[model samples]
Target: MPPQVVEAMQRPMVPHRGPEFSEFYIALIERLKRLHRTEAEVLLWPGSGSAGWEIAAVNLLEPGDVVVAGVTGDFGDRFALVASTFGADVRRVELEWGNAIVPERLDAALRAAPGAKAVLLTHNETSTAVTNPLAELTAVAQEHGALVLVDAVSSAGGIPIEFDAWDVDYLFSGSQKAWMCPPGVAIVVAGRRAWERTRETGTHRFFWDMDRNLEMTKKGWTPTTPPISLLYALDAATAMIEEEGLEAVFDRHRRLGDMTRAGLGQLGLRLLADDAYASNTVTAFFPPDGVEARTIIDRMASEFGITLAGGQAHLASSLIRIGHMGWVDDEDIESCLTALNDVLESV
Candidate 1:
C-alpha cells in the first residue's frame, strides 16, 4: 500500500519549454543530487529505466569496449544483454539467483577481464529481492580503475546508495519505483570519470543522448520536451523525502522491511533471499508447501484489497513479493500482513 500523496496528483502542469518549467527543472536536479548524494550531473530522459540502460551503454561505451557485469537476477541478466546488443563485450560474474553478488567473484572477473572498461551492477535486484554488495563491488572496481554503472530502479529512494562514496561512475533510476510517481522519466546521474568517457564514446544516440542533456541542463532545460506535470509531481514527491530527511527515509524502509520479514516468520513463510542479502524495499518469499503463489496473490487482491508485487522470470509463480518501497509504513504493512494471514489461513 502506498502512502497517501494526494498533492502529486493535484500538481498543475506547466509548459515544458517555458521559463517556469526551467526553474522547476533546475531546482529538481539539485534536489535529486541531494537524494543521490553526488555532485555529478543528473540527466532526465523521456523513457523508463530501460532507456537508462542503453543510455549508459551509448554514452560511455563504443563498439568492442568490454565490461564486467554482475548477474544475480532477471534485470541484471537483461542489462548485460542490452549492453551486448550495443556491441560491447559482456563478461559476467554469475551468482545464484536469490543471492547477492559476492565481491570476491567480481574481483576475480576483473582480474580475468583486464580489458574491462566498466562494471555493471544492479544495486537492488528486484527479481530476487536481494541488495548486492555495491559498496564492496564498487570498491573492487575502483581498485581496477574501472567505471561502475548501477541500475537502481527498485532501490533508489528506499535503500541507501551513495554514488560519490561508492565511486559509482554511472547510476540510473526510474521514477515509478521508490519515487511513487508516474513513469516516463529515467534519471541518470554520472560522475566526472563517466562524463569524460562520453567524450571518447563514438556511439550515436539522439534522444537518449546524455551530452545534449548535460548541455541543456546547465541552462535549466532539457535536450527534448519533458513530461512537465510528472516533473511537477516528482518535485512534490521527492521533496517530501528531503523534508523527512534521507536517514529517516531509509530507516522507515528498514523498519517496515524488518517488521514485514518478522510477520512472514510468524506465518511460517520462507524468504527467498538470504538474510544478509535481503533488501529493504521488497521481500520475496517462497510459497510454503502446497501453497499456490498465484492463487494466494489472487486471493490477497481479489478477496482482501491488498496489492502486493509479484516475482519475475522463473520465480514468478514460485514466490510472493511484497513491495515495501516508497511511502509505505506500519499501518499499511499491518493491513497487508493481515490480508496475507487471512488468505494463508484459508490456504
Candidate 2:
C-alpha cells in the first residue's frame, strides 16, 4: 500500500450515517465513476470480488436461466460455478488453462444456447495470466441478446476498460488489485439494462439486494455498516491514480509486462499465456524442464525475499505467476526477474 493510503486508513473512524461520512462517500463514488468511465450506478459492498459475482447472479438471474460462461481459467470457472449455484443453467465455453477465449468460440456457445440470459466473463484471468478480448466478446454476447457480466478483479484500474463504450450490463472489481488498496471492498457497476433485469428476476436477496442498495446510495450510505478504514484507503489510492493519470498508470503496467516476459524468455522459460493476449497485470510462465515450479517459488522467496504466486488447480505444479500491477515499477520487475534468473541457474 502507498504511504498516503496507509495514513488515510489510520485516521479515526466517523459515524457511518452522518453527513460528513455521506459527503466523503459521495465524493469517492464520483472518483470511482471516472475510473470506470461509466455513468452507471457504482456500488461498494463489504465483500471480496467473488461476492460481487454472487450478488450479480442472484439479482439478475432467475432459476433455470441459461448462462453462457467462458471458462478460460480458475476464476472464470468460479464465476460459472457461482451462477450455477444460484440456479442458472451455466453452459461453459471451456478452453485450455493457458488460452484466452476467442470471440468466435463465445459466439458459437451463445448460438448453441440461444436466448441465454447472460454471459459471464473474466476480464483478466489471473490464474492463467491472459486478458480476454472483452470488447469483442461483449459485442458477440449482445448480438445474441445476452447481457454481459464481467469480472475485472485483476485488471480494472491497470488495464483499459471503457464500461460505457462496451455497453457492459454489469462489471465488478476488488480494491486490492490495481486500485492500490487493501482488500475488503467489492466495487460493482450496474448499467441500465442490468437494473431493469434486477427488478424482474425471481431470485431472492436481502443483504445483496441492488434495489435496496440503490435506495441507500441515493442517501449516500450503504445498506450495512461500511468498512470505513478500507474506504479511506480507497479514497487516497484513487486520488493517487488520478494525480498520476490513468493512462500513465496503464502504460507503466504494459512496460513492466513486456520487460518481464522478455526477461523470462531470455532465461529459457516458456510463457503460459499466448503473446497475442497476455495480461499486463500478471504473467504466467513455466519453469525450465528439470526444474519444478515450487522449487523456483521457494528459492525466490527464501533467497531473494520476493514473493511469487504459484498457479491454481491443475496447473499448480507447472505454472508460476508474476504480478506487476499496482504499486510496482520498472525496477521492481527488473529485480524480480534477476532473482528468478538466479534461482533457475542454481536449480
Candidate 3:
C-alpha cells in the first residue's frame, strides 16, 4: 500500500451515515469516475472483484439470456462461470492459457450468437499475465449490436481504460490491484445503454443492485455500511495517483514491467506471455529446470523478504507471477529480481 493510503486509514473513523462520511464518499466516487473516464454512474460495493463479477451477472442478465464469454485464463473462465451460474446461456470463446483473445474470433462468435446480451471479456488476465486488446474487441462486439462487459480488475488503475470512449456497457474493477489499496471494495461502471437495459429487464436484484447503489451514492451514501477504512485508503491512493498524473503513473508501470521482463530474460527464465500482450501489472514466467514455482516464491520471501505469487490452477506448479502493480517501484522490482536470481542459483 502507498504510505499516504496507510496514513489515511490510520485517521479517525466516522459513522457511515454521518455528513462527513457522506461528503467523503461523494468526493471519492467523483475521483473514481474521472479515473474511469466515464460520465455514467459508477457503483461502489463492500466486496471483492469477484463480487463485481457477480454484480454484473445478477444485475444485467436474466435467466436464459445469451452471453458471449471470452475465456483466456483463470479470471476469464471464472467470469464465464459466473454468467452461467446466474442462468445465462454463455457461448464461450476459448483461447490458449497464455494467448490473448483474438478480436476476429470474438467477432465471429458474436456473429454466430447475434442475440448475445453482452460480450464478456477480461481486460487483463492476471493468471496468464496477458492484456487483451480491449478497444478492438469492444468495437467488434458493438458492430454486432451486443453490449460489451469488461472485467478490468487487474488493469484499471495501472493501464488506461476509457469506459465511455471505448463504448463499454459494463465494467468492473477491484480497489486492491492497481489502485494501491488493500482488498474489500469493488468499483463498477454501467453505461447509459446498460442502465436502460437494467430498467427494461433488470434481473433478480437486492443488495448488489446498481440502481440502488446509484441512487444512494447520489445522496452521498451506500446501500450498506461500506468498509470505511478501505475507502479512506482508496481515496488517498487515488489522490496520490492524481498527484503523479495518470500518464506518468501508467508510464511508470510500463517501465517496471519492461524492467522485470528483461531482468527475467537475463536470468535465463521464460515469460509465459508474448511481449505484445504482456500485462503491465504482472508477469508470469516459467521457473528454471528442476525447480518448482512455489519453491522460488517461498525462498524469495524467506531469504530476501521479497514476496512473489505463483500461478493458479493448472499452472500452479509450472510458473511464478511477479506483480508490478500498485506501490511498486524500480527498487522493488530489482529486489524481487535479485531474490529470484539467488533462488535460481541455489535451487
Candidate 4:
C-alpha cells in the first residue's frame, strides 16, 4: 500500500450505512470515474480482481450468447474461461504470449460470429507484459455491433486509458494494482448499454448483480457488509493520484517503464514482448544463458531483499518479471536493477 493509503486505513472506522460513509462512498465513486475516464457508474466490490470477470460475465451474458474473446496471456485466457463457464459461445482470437491482440483479428472473429453479444479484451496482460491496443479494438467491436468489455486490472492507473473516448461498455480493475491500494476491493465501470444488456440477460446472479449494486450506489451505500478500511485506503490513494494529476502519473509510469526496459537491455536480458506493445507497469524478460529464472528470483530476494516475479505456468522457469508501477520511483528501479546485475554476475 502507498504510505498515505496505509495511514488512511488506520483512521477509526465509521458506520458504513450512515451519512458520513455516504459522503466518502460518493467521493470515491467520483474519483473512480475520473480514473476510469468514463461518465458511467463505477461499481465497487469487496472482492479480488478475479471477481470482476465473474461479475461482468454474469451480468451481461446469458447462456448460448456468442462472444469474441481476445486471449494474449493468462488473464486473457481466464476471461475466455469465465465466458465459457457462463455458457457463451466464445470465439477465441489468440496470439503468442508476448504479442498484443490486434484489432484485425477481433474484427474478423466478431464478423464471423454473427450476433456476437460482446468482445472481451485484456487491456494489459500482466503475465506477458503486453498492452493491447484498446482504442482500435473497441472501434472494431462497435463496427461489428458488439459490446466492448475489458479487464484493465494491471493498467488502469499505471497507463492512460480513455474509456469514454473508446466507447468501452464494460471495464474493471483491481485496487491493489495501479490504484496503489491493498487488495480486497475491485472497481467495475459499466456504460448504459452494458446495463441494458444485463437486464436482458437471464443469468442468475445475486451478489454480483449490477442492478442491485447500482441502486445501492445511488443511495450511497452497499447492499452487504463492505470493506470499509480498504475503501479508505483506496480513497487516500486516489486522492494522491488526483493531487499529482492523472497525466503526470501516466507520464511517470511511461518514463519508469522506458528506464527499466533500457536498464534490462543493458544487462543483456531478452524482453518478452516487442517494444510497440510492452507494458508500462510490468516487464517480462528472459534470463541470461545458463541462469534459471528461479535462481535469479531467489537470489534477489534471499540476498538483496528484493523480490522479483517468475513467469506463470509453463513459462515459470523460462522468464522473470519486474514490476515498476504503483508508488515505485527511480531509486527503487535503480536498486532493483543493481541487485539484478549482481544476481546475474553471481549466477
* Per-prediction TM-score: 0.97, 0.99, 0.98, 0.99
Per-residue accuracy of model 4 over 53-127 as CA lDDT, tens digit each: 999889999879999999999999999999999898999998889999887788788779999989999999999
Off by over 4 Å in 3: none
Score each candidate by Cα lDDT.
0.88, 0.93, 0.90, 0.91
Please give the lDDT score at residue 38 for candidate 4.
82
Candidate 2 achieves a global lDDT of 0.93
**Higher-scoring candidate on TM-score, 2 or 3:** 2
Deviation of model 2 at 322, angstroms: 0.4
Model 2 agreement with the true structure over 1-347: per-residue lDDT tens digits: 78999999998999999999999999999999999999999999999888888988889998899999999999999999999988899999999987999999998898899889999999999999999999999999889989999999999999999999999999999999999999999999999999999989977799899999989988999999999999999999999999999999999999988999999899988999989999999999998888889999999999999989999999988889999989999999999998987888788
| Overall local distance difference test of candidate 1 | 0.88
Task: Report the error of model 1 at residue 13, Å.
Answer: 3.2
Residue 176 CA displacement from its true place in model 2, Å: 0.8
Cα deviation in Å at residue 342, candidate 3? 1.7
What residue pairs are clashing in model 3? Answer: none
Candidate 1 vs candidate 3, TM-score winner = 3
Of models 1 and 2, which has the larger lDDT?
2
lDDT score, candidate 2, position 147:
94
Q: After superposition, how far is residue 69 of candidate 3 from its true place, in Å?
A: 0.6
